[model samples]
Target: MRMPEAVTPAEWNKAHEELMAKEKELTRAQDRLAAERRRQPGVRIDAEHGFTGEGGRFSLVDLFEGRRQLIVYHFMFAPGSKRPCSGCSMFVDNLGDPAHLNARDTTLAVVSRAPYPEIAAVREQRGWTVPWYSSFGDGFNEEMGVTVDDNDSFGLSVFIRDDTSVYRTYFTRGRGVEKLGTNWSLLDLTPLGRQETWEDSPEGVPQESPYAWWRLRDEYGD
Candidate 1:
């Protein structure tokens, strides 16, 4: 394997400074992108998607926990599967404290299509605190475009509230969701990101089944 060549201090400093300039430029561009995303009009969430958690059955609005914004990770815990999705599990592990998001009037929750008791046991065993819910057989996953037929895929959906009415602000799937630490940042990447089957992506852009392409990171080559 090739390694970076050792260089004199002055050469290294100059190279680092050059890279920093481009990084800063990228940061500014991201700021502009976020400004535009905030302006994008939202679509009303009319589907009666039901979710159940340890507390009991709750409407989609309840997932917001009274926050104005709600970020949901559509975890790929397919029904009757004995193991949770490795990729989705790692995504939850990457999340920081929910309190910080809570302070900003946002709540991040993990939703899956598995039974409540089933997912709860996994959550407890894994020692995860982030709110999790079961959308089992309610067609919520199908509506969100995360589950196509027998395949189960992972994605992120963001919602915001206006007085008791809720709207879907954004959603993303595939690597479109990579490297995003904050839910809002991830959602802002596309107006209707990741053109995948089962996705409500309007006409325009190529798409395929949501659960067809992705695999555990290490299994990609297989």
Candidate 2:
């Protein structure tokens, strides 16, 4: 690897302080972005949508579980698939307990096109306590733009409920979902910073093939 130059403690502290200034600026910029996101207008969800969870059938509004806000993670698990998407699994592995989000009057859940039985199998195997539901036989996935041509795709959608009505506040897909994964945030703190081929790491820095390290939580070390 292209190692950093050997420096005295005083020089190292000086460099660290210089980087801290830019880091603080970046933090403020991120806060502004979040504020802007909250201000964006949303659309009313008037049509009914169905989902099957551990407790049987439910509507989209029911998924909110009486919370004012809901965040649904569209996991890419199509019908008849042997397993869930590795990427989605890895993303969910970093999810924290939901009580904190629930405390904020928000509910979080995952939805997939896979059958309830299949969804339950994986959830149990992974020991995930998060709520998950199946949208099979329902156009919810397609209507939400998370399914295309019989293929499932990843997405994160936010909704707000007012009285008896619900509205979609925001929807993000593809790389936009990265921010939800704490794994990436933790990696960003390391000198190698994800160590993916797309990263601008110094020459000779260790990097594995992209997605090579991905494995189901239970599949690793086996």
Candidate 3:
């Protein structure tokens, strides 16, 4: 297997220093982008949809769990399908404790078109404790554009609320969701860069379409 070139310790340090400069530049750019995102206009939500989950029924605003900001991970599990998207499973597996995000006034949740019973079974089997709610019979997923043409698609949505008004602040999907995972974020720093089919990697490096190899966390073979 071809590996990156070996260099003397001094040379390596110098290279690292140069890369650190670029890394810092990227960090500043990311900060600026985040600031810009915070200022982006939000779309006010007027319709109400019911959701069923842990404590029973809830509305979109209730999903915020009393927090000012709500981040919902749109899981691709359809109402009657036993096939849960392996990519969505992996993404949820990578999430750390939500308490840290809660400390900053944000609540993270998962919303899917699957019935609550199905959601409960998957959560129990996979040991996921995040607050996931069912959008079944509510048209919430369809309204959010994740259930377009009656097909399930995965994404993330951000919302902010006032006393009685809720507005969607942001949304992301595909590669935009990749940065949320430590595994993907670390891989992004490597030369091969996740080795995904869509990435512009060097010739001969291993590559596959995203989710081609994803599996439920516990289903991975040793």
Q: What TM-score goes with each of the models?
A: 0.81, 0.79, 0.80
lDDT tens digits by residue: candidate 2, 1-222: 899999999999999999999999997775445545655667898778889999889998899889677888899999999878999998888897665455445677999999999999999999998899999998989888988888778988888787778888788888878776554432332233445675555566457777766555445431
Q: What is the C-alpha lDDT of each candidate?
A: 0.77, 0.77, 0.77
Q: Against the true structure, candidate 3 has what lDDT?
A: 0.77
Q: Write the per-residue lDDT of candidate 1 for residues 35-116, one digit (tens) a residue.
A: 5665577889788788999889999999988877788899999778989989888888888766545544567889998899
Checking candidate 2 for backbone clashes, the offending pairs are: none
Superposition error at 115 for model 2 (Å):
0.8
Top TM-score: which candidate number? Answer: 1
The reply for model 3, stretches above 4 Å from the true place, is 181-222
> Which residue pairs in model 1 clash with each other?
none
RMSD of candidates 1 onward, in order: 12.4, 13.3, 13.2
